[model samples]
Target: MAATDDFSKDNILGEGWTGTVYKGVLPDGSILAVKQLWRSSQSGKGLQAKMETLGRVKYW
Candidate 1:
């Protein structure tokens, strides 16, 4: 998908080696953090680690 201007620097919430995270407000008035993954790090092992970490999370 194409990123719009609305999700620009002004809407960025944080940034790291992984990617830049943006704060977005949905139509239901819910706020969400959208993490734009780094293309270079989109490997199978990284994805597996992410899944494992998510599975190990006991709470939000």
Candidate 2:
């Protein structure tokens, strides 16, 4: 994705049990963070629900 420049290694911000976090930028020049979730049995709708429940998260 353009946001993460195809998830380039240089853009990696951090990693966690669930996935890796990447630094991203939007076309408007807004900076954001994205998480690339690890593959698991829980995917598609199941994964969507899990993410929705998370709402906004803060991690250092």
Candidate closest to the true structure, highest lDDT: 2
- Per-candidate local distance difference test: 0.68, 0.86
lDDT of 2 by residue, 1-60 (tens): 899999999999998777899999999988888889887776689778868875666655
Q: Write the residue-wise lDDT of candidate 1 on 14-46 in tens digits.
A: 887777778777767666666677776568998
TM-scores, each model vs. reference: 0.61, 0.68
How big is the positional error of residue 3 in model 1, measured in Å on the Cα after superposition?
10
What's the residue-level lDDT of 28 in candidate 1?
73
lDDT, model 2? 0.86
Question: What's the TM for model 1?
Answer: 0.61
**In terms of TM-score, how similar is model 2 to the real structure?**
0.68
Q: Which candidate gets the maximum TM-score versus the true structure?
A: 2
Model 1 Cα shift for residue 43 (angstroms): 3.3
Q: Which residue pairs show collisions in model 1? A: none
